[model samples]
Target: MTQSDFDDGNEDDVPEWADRVMADVAREVRRRRKEMKWTAQKLADRCEEIGYPIPRNVIANMESGRRAVLPLVEVMVLAKALYTHPLRLIYPVGYVEEVQQLPLTYPVDTAKAMRWFAGLNENYQADHRMLHHHIAHASALERALFAVQGEERQRWAAERAIDDTARAKALRTQADFAERAARAKDELCQVRSAIAADGEPLPDLPDTLADVDPAEGYERDTD
Candidate 1:
C-alpha cells in the first residue's frame, strides 16, 4: 500500500486558502501554548521525553505560520504538551468538543463524555489515541463495525483508504476486546431470548473480526 501524499508546503508555496488554515492553526497553537505558559523549547522537550521528537525551531515555525506541513502526530503531541485537545489546534475559535470521541459500551452521556475527555492528561491521551485514531486514518471496515442500531447517522467521509502505517500499527492493541464484542449477540433481539435462555456456551468466533481491534480505530461522527 502506498502512503498518502499529504500536502506540505511553506506559506509562500501554499495557496491562500491553505495559508489561511495554517495561520488559524498557528494562532490556536500559539494561544494554547501561551495559555499554559510553556515555551517552544519546553514543548519540544516534553514531546521528546514521551517518544516523538520535535525541535523548538519546528514549533516556532509552526506558530509563526512558516511551517506548512503539520503532521497529525505533531499536532497530537503538541496538544498533549499544551494540556489541551488536538482539536483546539485546528478547529475554529470559540469551538469546544472532545479532541476525539470516546467509544463507550452504551448509554453514554454526551456531556459526561465531554467532561471525561476534558479531564484526560497526556498520560491518558496516549491510550485514548490508541482507543480512537484521527478520523483521517480510520478504515472502512472499522467505520462499519463501530456504530449501533438506530442512532442518527454520523459523518462517513473520514473513513480513509488503507496505508496508514503509524496509525494502523497502533491499531493492533487489545485483540481480545474485539473478540468479545464480535461474539456478543444483540441483547434486544427477540429471538435472542431462546439462545440466551438456553445457557449454551458461546461457540468459537468467526474469522471476520479476528484481528480487528476497536480501540485502535473508528470513524468520527462529525468534523
Candidate 2:
C-alpha cells in the first residue's frame, strides 16, 4: 500500500517522504497487531487500559492507511501497547534495509538510522563522543563476562580429564578472560564518571557491575 491509500485530502501540505513514513508506520502497526493475534478492538482496549485510549476506528483507519497524521505521543503509546520500542516501529530495522533519515536525504542503513535516533552513534553527534565510548565499554564488559563463564566451564571439564597439559591450557585461558573482564569493568566505571562529569545523565550499570564505584577511579587519579 502507498501513501495515497491513506490520503486525508491534505497531501499537498505534507511532504511525500513524510507521507511514506506514515504509510510504513501503518503497515507496521497492522503487521505487528496481526502477528500478536490482536484484533482492532482488543488493541483499542489495551490502549484504554494503558490510559491513552485510541479508539477502535482510529486504529482501523491507521491500519488501513486512511489516517495520515500520526502524533509522536501516539507512536510512543502504540509502541508501549505493542511491547516494543518506538524506534522499532518507526525504523523497522530488520524488516527493511534502509530508511530515509530526513526529507530529501538519501536513505541510509536502517541500523545506522536507529543508532542516530537513540543518540548512540558518535558520528551522528561528534561533540558528545563519550556516550558512544560508554556503550562500547559496557558491551565489551558483558561479552567479557560471558567469555569468563565459558572459560570457567572449560577449565572444570579439563580438570575432570586429569590431563595436566589440558588443565594448564584451560587455566591460562580462564585467567586471560578474567583479566579482560576486570579491565572492561574498570574502564566502564571510569567512562561512567567521565560521562557524569560532562553533566550528562549516567547510564545504568549492569547488575554485575552495579556495585563498582566510579568515584574510586577518580580517587585513584588524585592519588
Candidate 1: where is the Cα deviation over 4 Å? 1-14, 95-223
Error at 80, model 1, angstroms: 2.1
lDDT of 2: 0.73
Model number with the top TM-score: 2
lDDT of 2 by residue, 1-223 (tens): 1123233444453487787788777778888899999999988998898999999999999888788699999988899899888888888877877776766566678788888888767664475566566666577667656755666777686677677887887788778777776776676666666665665566665565665554454432232
Clash pairs for candidate 2: 6-65
- Cα-based RMSD of candidate 1: 20.7
Q: What is the C-alpha local distance difference test score of each model? A: 0.50, 0.73
Model 2 RMSD in angstroms = 6.6
Error of 2 at 172 (Å): 21
List the lowest-lDDT window of 10 residues for candidate 2.
Answer: 1-10
